[model samples]
Structures are given as structure tokens and as C-alpha cells.
Target: MNAIEKLQSERQRVVARLAEIDRILGQYEELQRIAESYLASGASHTADSGTVTDSVKTQAEAQREPSVTEPNLPRVKSPKTPMVEFERVVIELLSEAEVPLDRSALYKALLDREIVIGSPDESSDLNTLSARMSRMKDKVVNVSGHGYWPKDRAFLPGGYVPTGVDDMPSQDATSESGLV
Candidate 1:
């Protein structure tokens, strides 16, 4: 072959090698992109798992610890004595009465005993006495429909009296009579 033809053949071979190199570089770029995407996806998945584990651990810890407050917890008031002096006076008045005294009667009894002598404030209304009676009904004494009664009437000095005439005698009376 002549020199020009040989030179032409060598140039064609060089051009083909350059095209192969370009194709290999393109493939390498594609592989590098896929690897980067996979790494990012793996990192995101790990982060999500870590967050879920941390949340579950926090919830478990909260449930395991004791609470500071509980519902319907009974609270004892401070300076806890059996009964106040005013409450005792009221009980004394009820123990002496033959019939069930209403709230007004109880108030009058209090005034007679000089326990609640006079109004303390300018409002000076009967509502204050009514409120006190309500508090006594709920807290200090046991009250029936009509009036207030002492809780431990059996222990009182005068003893208990039946409110109604038709009411039967107590178990003590029946046992004493040998009805059983």
C-alpha cells in the first residue's frame, strides 16, 4: 500500500478509539448518578427509622413514670379537728328540739346560743346564713328533708327524738321488747 493510504487507515482507527472512549465516559457518568441517588435514598430511610424509634421510646418512658396528679383523690383539710365549736353548738340545738327545725329555725337557734351573733359585713344578708346552713348540711352534720340533725345523736346528752308520730320505734326498742 502507498503512504497516503496507510496514513488514512491509521486516522480512521484513531477516530474509532475516540468514539469508544466517549461512550465509556457516558456510561461511567450514568453509573455515578445512580450510585448517588441510592446513597441519598438510604440516608433518608435511616433517618425515618431513627425518628420512629425515638418517638416510641419517648411514649414508653412517659407511660412508665408516675403522674403528679390523680383523679378523685381524697384530700384531708389542714388543722383537722373532729368538729368546730360552732358545729357543736348547732348540734346541741338540734338535740334539744322535739321536731325537725328548718334552716330559719337553725339560724334562730344559732342566734339564741350567741354562736353567730351578728353580721360581719355590710351586705349583711340572710343569704349568708343560708350558705352557711348549706355548707353545714354537706359537711358538718347529716340533714334529712326538713332540717339538720347531728350525726351521732345517740351519744348526745338529750338523745334523739322521732320526727314523725307514725314512725316505728328503733331497733334498740324492739330488741329490748324481745320482738326477735
Candidate 2:
């Protein structure tokens, strides 16, 4: 009924429980060994029948039916095309932005998409993307430092003032005299 007696009683119970668990674990280990031995013997028998496990299709079954499978040929990888990968990405980015984007903005967009530029000449690099975009005059129109946009008028983004239009004098100018 005192603290010392209570502590001793609890310790004894814990020791007994641990001993029971150890006994159970030993039996499990022995069962696992027996299962492995039985499977090993059974596998030799299956090997004698000449097939391994996708539910063990036997040699007899293989011959009694036509094997529809052709022999496993080496896989041939298709050749890569000559198109620059980043060029496509740049087009897509500009299309999504709907505005003409410069190199830095396009670079930032690429970074936002987790694409880091590699080197000066790599397709994903800033210089390479700029060069590639410059060459695509039919596809993209430059807007100075702002960015690039699709060349078609319908695809041109809102708020864009086309060159020379804002600067040109209105064609409606007439002489002040009211002569017909």
C-alpha cells in the first residue's frame, strides 16, 4: 500500500508483459523461417515447369496456345526536332501575357515558371531567347523595353498604340474657307 511496494508491483507487471511479447516475437520469427523454406522448395518445382510468376504461365500452356507476344525488341527513341525549345515557351508566355514583352520581362516570366536560364547561348538563356524572338518578326512584334506581342491586330493587347498612328496628323484637315 506504500510507494515502495506499489513501485515494485508495477515493475513486476511490466517485466512479465515484456517476456510475453518476446515469446510471441520468437514464434513469429520461426514461422517466417518455415514459410521461406516452403516457398523455396515450391519455387524449384515451378522452375522445373519452366515459368516464373505472373501467376506462373507454364511451358505446356505456352505451347498449347499461340503466344501473341512478339520478342521484346529494343525501344527506339525518336530523333529530336530542330526547333528551339525555349522559342516555343517564349511564344506561349507572350501569348498568355497578351503583350509585347522585352527580354528581362520574358526572363522574369520564365523564372516565375521555374525555368532558370543556363548560359549565354542556351535556348533558355536570356540572350538566346531574345535572339530567337527577334528572328520571329512574323510571329512577334517588338515594343522596345516593354516586351513582345503577337503580330496580328486582333491578337494585339489592349492599350497598345501602334507606331506612327499617334504621331500622324489627322487626314480631315481642310482649308478654313467654305469653298465647295
- Cα RMSD of all models vs. native, in order, equals 36.1, 23.5
TM-score of each: 0.32, 0.34
lDDT of 1 by residue, 71-156 (tens): 22222111111125556676677767654567777766765654432355424624665655566753334345556665433212
> Per-residue alpha-carbon lDDT of model 2 for 1-180, expressed as tens digits?
999988776666555454444544544543454445456445332232522122223445434443322233222212121234445666688766634667778777875653434453435466766766678887677755556775542222233333454533223222322221
* Positional deviation of residue 109's Cα in model 1 after best superposition, in angstroms: 1.5
What candidate 1 gets wrong by more than 4 Å, as runs, is: 1-83, 117-125, 138-145, 152-180
In model 1, the Cα lDDT at residue 85 comes to 53
- lDDT (Cα atoms) of all candidates against the true structure: 0.46, 0.50
Candidate 2: worst-modelled 10 consecutive residues by lDDT: 73-82
Can you give the lDDT of residue 106 in candidate 2? 78
User: What TM-score does candidate 1 get on C-alpha atoms?
Assistant: 0.32
